[model samples]
Target: MTFQGSGPLDTSGVSAGGGGGGGRIAMGGGLGLVVTVVALLFGVNPGDIMGGSGSTGSQQVSADQSELQERIDSCTTIEQANSDDVCRLIATKNSLNDVWPTLMNGYTDPDMKIFSGSINTGCGAASSAMGPFYCPSDETAYFDPSFFQELTRMGGSDGPLAQEYVVAHEFGHHVENLTGVLAKGQRMGNDGSVRIELQADCLAGVWAQHADDGPDAMLAPLTDDQIASVIQTAKAIGDDTIQGSGSNPEGWTHGSARQRQRWFTTGYESGDPSRCDTFATDDL
Candidate 1:
């Protein structure tokens, strides 16, 4: 799918205000360490792992502006978004901002941060290896663009929709946050976490359905093969596939490949956000 043009942006730490990080704290240990390690494979917010307070440690975050960040700020056209990974992320973010408001009443845009190495957040400091996560404390989605390359490493498509699915999934967490169901995902021990994660996949799918419709649409209509690739991407991040032989349903925080694919298909085929109620579905 193609994106629209001239969505110029200037973000501060991850907002419209420009500059570098607000601050940073030294990385931490104990439960923080455990959650970080676990979230490394998926887009889980570490703050939610603690049910609140995402402390990485006790050190201030590094504040230098990166060359990579400079390039992200310069990206203003669809061509760049199509050619560059970071640009694609920005474009996807813009598209999500456009599509979600119609389905969600009083929906507002979420702040986004593009970072390398480490950065500070409303929750706490986080490193790139933790993968992409949304900091509900600050209403921001954090991404280390380099992580997208891991799609192929995880046996998923490295195509545009796959990356967009990731972006949408993180934003889906924001939508959940607004709907007051995000806190339900705090129960990592039971099926609560898995259900929320699957719901996020479905919400991302909901965005995919209407991404190319309406005048505010930022993306071109998706092709059937592109949709299949998104499904492949959804299946790639499944806990069963990620855990391989060690996979256990008892320990699953995110759903299995089948559950993820089914919910995403559910949203795409239905094109209705109301149908994305993974929590109400016993079959999930």
Candidate 2:
């Protein structure tokens, strides 16, 4: 419902499956990635666990190709984009493409993949369990729309903006990849992981602030309710929230609920990507 019917959605860069028919489960480790879910959220290596560049992949998903095709086909109109998941993703991806370049020099769009079960990636093998993530090697963002259903079970909203927040968060990692901050995060401790994750959250807010702006705005004016939904999604995915109330900060990779909410609000209010420099701040 956030899309403004500005124009037809471009799904050319989007793939419903993995690159090169990706669907491979890695040996020894499950599906994993660094950005967003951060190596399956339990210290796994996405690059190491995922079978890398030259391994046999899988067509492991069980979704109906015809059904997926129908959804993609129907997403040409903005009205359809409002109601359909695939269409919404398409619209959101296009919106991000429109927004990021204005904020960063030499910004490039990341490949957005929607999949079920397992998929192969430049970073390695991945499953829906690793949640949404960005692979720097391929410069792509991977998403499992089913993860939204899981978000709902985790006490997060299933609103369109909430879903978009996750998309933006993954793309935030793409921005980090471009700026070389993601590499810094790779060598960080738990505290560093928290900083990177919070920075991504903030960058998501920066996207929201500008998504409906400019002459070619692809989205309608964002609302308070929608922003609140995004906040709920942020809180829902917080490591402290996921680890229960008294979770130790030492063991938490992503920041706490308060920190995530604060950082996102910082970005939204500032509407500046420069304000999202979590590594430079000690407040978190």
Candidate 3:
């Protein structure tokens, strides 16, 4: 993705922090090697950002300003040449802010936590092993670049668009949380879980459609093949695809590969939230 910001940011030696249990780490510079782990945490269902299952109940996470700032500063890519990760995060938020308001009317922005090995969220303490996620308890998103290595191992290529797609997917959950649709769907069980994830996938597609239009957008117009690659990545992460048929299909949280592709295409083609109505469909 080609982010068209006022100009690239100049965060050459910035750090990620301002929270407890904080420490400094060096930033990596290579685009090919840089990774991001996001937590898509929510109520009822754990959103994709942190790659967990279920939501937050009554959890309290005390804020430690300097430490939190330290964590944010520490969450950087390898080279830290132009602060691309920070720029990417800011640009994505700008994009989400652009579209989500149309769907929710007055949705407030959520805090984004960038960490390396682990982080403290309103939901609880989480390590990179848990993956990227969104925490509903604090209405924030968490990410670690380490998980991109796992995605590469699974045959997925890491690109700016791929990373943007992941970020947009997590933002999708934040949209659902504000609308209460996520909680409503969660009450519906596994079927609800599948629908929720599919909708998030659809939401990501919606964001992708408008990504190139914004001044601060980091994505270029996606090709059909590039789109397919993203869809394939989505399929690869499907509950069924990840766990396989050997696992009980009925207990699946994310939808099946077929279902995920179908929903993603549905949103990609239409570019409308209405087209992502997993609740009205019985296909899953």
What TM-score, computed on C-alpha atoms, does each candidate reach? 0.83, 0.86, 0.73
Model 2 stretches with alpha carbons more than 4 Å out: 18-45, 48-66
Query: What number of clashing residue pairs does each candidate have, in the order they appear?
Result: 10, 4, 54
Write candidate 1's Cα lDDT for 224-271 as tens digits: 988889889878878777767867787777888999999898888888
TM-score winner between candidates 1 and 2: 2
User: In the order shown, what is each candidate's alpha-carbon RMSD?
Assistant: 4.8, 4.3, 9.2
Which regions of candidate 1 fall more than 4 Å away from where they truly are? 4-42, 48-64
Q: What tens-digit string does per-residue lDDT give for candidate 3 at 33-113? A: 122121122212332223223322222222333444554455343233124555565456655766677656778877676
lDDT of 3: 0.60
Off by over 4 Å in 3: 5-86, 214-218
Query: In candidate 3, residue 248 scores what lDDT?
Result: 58
Give the best candidate by lDDT. 2
Model 3 residue 40 distance off true place after TM-score fit, in angstroms: 9.1
Model 2 agreement with the true structure over 156-270: per-residue lDDT tens digits:
8999999888888888888988898888887886677788889998998999999988666888999999999989978877777886765777777788889989999999999
